[model samples]
Target: MSAPPAPLSELPLASRQDGSHPRPQLIRSTWADLDGTWSFRHDDADTGLAAGWCAGLPAAQEIIVPFPPESVASGIAEPGFHRVVWYARTVSADDVATAGRSEHAPVVLLHFGAVDYRARVWIDGRFVGEHEGGHTPFTFDVTALVADGADHVLVVRAEDDPHDLTQPRGKQDWHEDAHAIWYRRTTGIWQTVWLEAVPATSIAHLRWLPAGPAAVDLSVRLRGRPAAGARLRVALRFDERDEDLGTIDVDVPATATSVDVTVPIARQRNGQAEDELTWSPERPRLVDATVSLLDADGGVTDAVSSYLGVRTVGVARGAFLLNGRPYDVRSVLNQGFWPDSHLAAPSRGALRREVELIKDLGFTACRIHQKIEDPRFLYWSDRLGLLLWGETPGAYEFSATAVQRLTREWMDAVDRDASHPSLVTWVPFNESWGIQHVADDPAQQAYSRALTDLTRALDPTRPVVSNDGWEQQNSDIITVHDYEGDGAVLARTYADEAARDRLLSGMGPAGRRILVDGAEDRGQPVMLTEFGGIAFQPGTRRADGWGYTAATDAEDWIARITALYDAVRASTFLAGSCYTQLTDTMQETNGLLTAGREPKAPIEQIRKAVRGRP
Candidate 1:
């Protein structure tokens, strides 16, 4: 069903929504892409500020927005370490102006999807705002800066310390050259930068929590204060099935910044119909909803479009359940790196293709290791029906400063991405990263538990894994990583119930205890979160490449992986298993597919092994 025409004031600034739009989860009709060529230069000596180059730069080379300087896609593909970089872009009044809304003044909001380490922005030599996180997004209200029709030169100074281990730098190498498990750095703006106009009063944030298959709770935060007798209208429909589920209208309390409303599914339907409305990897159903703020006169003051996916994710009876049904998770570890672009995907299509590729491998889920992935990737994951365990990058050291930085950024990420239906769990740390002394140190253990508790507090819908794949406490799932290539030996550990119990009690895979001492095991589902990293080169493996194990041929690779998967499936104690990786990353060649995303072996056979089928 085609959407009713949006108000002229809400005319679309872009043509498509397949990933070009940065914030796909919550979209407004007014926005523009600032993702092409931009004036850029390297600040090797950090002299840009002292030299007063914010207004403009001298002989600045061109680089692509949303692609970091270290990437080939960016015009300047300098490989060596560069600590600081700058980006300059021009935005016109039209870029930030909503069509046909002249009476009620609109505010132009400049948005950055992400930038590395730290970013300080200046508009026409005037300092605007600064943000510190590299993976999540930040926005600045630039209405005053660009209210005049004259063009505004937006300057951004991005500072990333290549050697800063205390920061949450995920898999980005500090070394000049990319090496084992670490890829090149992403400096400066690495995600779509855009502008949009909204009423002075608009929706600041929107969060959806499924109350069940039949209802959802909406946490709506207003950008500006509302007058008395204001009302919120929510309309839900499934565009794919042309099904209009229902609508809800609620009154907003005066002078309130945040409000909560519960919406029930409108039409009562049969079991099959309700099931059809429910989301799963097989169906991937999504209900599009438009939320409008109506004033006392019943005119729309502001409106935003979002989607809802009704499904339940939890652990019960020692099994992972989707919609309360047992779900055997076939998942892969995703680093989300491209050969040409490193951390930045080559294009919007690449993000969608990544999700498609994971689904193509017969895997139902992915654990985005180390990195807080791009929002566009999360958008595709939501639309395409692949489960995700959202993780933040870990800082190498534990300090009060590190704690503050990580906690702030992690909360921002949780606030930004929790609405995604595919994000089924929160994993704060991995293998005792940042909290290296978690095994023994009380302070470190508290830090880990604090993150888990904090994440649960922010978004309580999903489970939390304080630390994955090692010395874990207060984790919802007991996850262990073992590269035991011998399927028989691996099977004896995970497949045997007594061995599984013993392993959970104290003994862990690879000499890393699954649960730290004094942490009770609440009969949580056990998963071999990482295994079967068999690197196969088809003809010859790279001499410098690394994997948990090596395979000489397609036959050998398939047999080993199949045996390992069968071993994991052999256990009644096991809820799921995740393959070590989806694609080869940098110097690591354990991927089922190469870094270029080509299957090393026959795709069908690999799928069979992943699914444990004939």
Candidate 2:
């Protein structure tokens, strides 16, 4: 056919780069996105390493960067599995225009948003570094090699075993065909790859936590060698109403790489204004801040821009609390897949619109099912005001290798996303998919609990769900999954105190124990985390699609969904409820919207159902 349409990554800018800062958590002015056309090939035989293809790939076709070769958007939608792949691209002078080349030994980092499985990289044919884990980002400092001031070619080789059951491949069917809950695979480089130049000394990572009613705490980590008499300055503002909520300056110790400081904000005189200063789905007030690293002479050496929302999350009196208020949570299970892009988003605007669409449908939170989302999505969630339940993709098999892979990757995901104010909960496991025997297996139960405790150690600010839906080894929130189609049956099952007590004790929903650790009630909040999968597509059947339950017509679909919401709301037991899903995937058609994100019913009806209102 004719030439395919230009990919989004290659298109020129008007409202470009998805309309948000790349790497929103920490942003410096000196950076550029390496997200365009690239030379590509599938090394199915795995001869690239021995053949020395890392130095260069002589014969390769063109494909779009950031879009996996499995996707149509990549211009190389190969259906068959390829265990190995290689990509090559030249770094243009324009790409490095902002990376100040004059500084003596300035640090320049090549940041990969994400690469599936394991990725090995080379700069100008010289080996640089490699990173494992498919979801979280990794950066390599190429300053030493690229400092020669010449052309540089980035060649990447990625290895992913389609048959590896122990790998944390979430919802990716190993077989050639997509079936059941599993969808397509994203083999390599499914996110943006870019570069940033920073001063020798800089701020590496940090997080802002709501310390109390009137203060927020900061844990800042510095990179490189600390200078004597050096200092760090931070300034905070809200809505630009106050230029400086607090201006903090602390002297940096010569040997210290990290520092913690508490910034106290002036309490608002008006109660409503004070509430507005806090972040929520209704009123998303963001606190903007600037971080500056000063040299011994007090001259700014490295400066970056960042922001956070002031909020706290907890479980108290058997209810989920946000900002100390018993806020009811309405969540949707988001697979974050696209017809054109699979696991990767179609565009940056799509990421923003995804958040707006969830809000439009009246969801307070989104359980990002089985995948670590792009940081751009988290940035929009923080900006547009939506809560998130961060969940990791599970491995199908239980083994030491599986546990080790899932645990390390999950922790890295937690560390990358813990700074986002919108992330309210950490779900390390789901449905006990990896540790399937956790309910009766002592070893599995201990591993699950240990993982939960480890997540807490990483970020104590958010609640940890040891294993969601069923067979939970440890959890701060008791969640259960039930797909009972009838609203009347669903209501009666969770009608009164006795039914609630029964569920907390031994009886389970979906025929799986809610708590498998054999412990008494810890007085945790109970939620209908998964329910109501009413599948209804308006047109003819395609792709042999199906759902947990099917609806007849649009009106019937809306009514059935509404009745379930009403039942959940009427129950005296549940603090919150999450529906089965937001959009229909390949073979699973039980979605309020289609895979392309088109609403099956009217937006108003869906929003009303989600809100539990007429």
Assess each prediction's global lDDT (C-alpha) against the native.
Answer: 0.84, 0.83
- At residue 5, candidate 2 shows an lDDT of 18
How do the predictions measure up, each by TM-score?
0.96, 0.95
| Positional deviation of residue 469's Cα in model 2 after best superposition, in angstroms | 0.4
Query: lDDT (0-100) at residue 612 of candidate 2?
Result: 71
Among residues 3 or more apart in sequence or in different chains, the pairs in candidate 1 whose N, CA or C atoms overlap within 3 Å are none
RMSD of each: 2.8, 5.8
Task: Please give the lDDT score for candidate 2.
Answer: 0.83
Q: Compose the digit string of candidate 2's lDDT tens values, residues 175-206.
A: 98897788989999999998877667778887
What ranges in model 1 sit over 4 Å off?
1-16, 97-105, 266-273
The alpha-carbon deviation from the true structure for residue 445 of candidate 2, after best TM-score superposition, in angstroms, is: 0.5
The candidate scoring highest on TM-score is 1
For model 1, residues 115-175, the per-residue Cα lDDT tens digits are 9989999999999999998888998988788887788899999999988888888788888
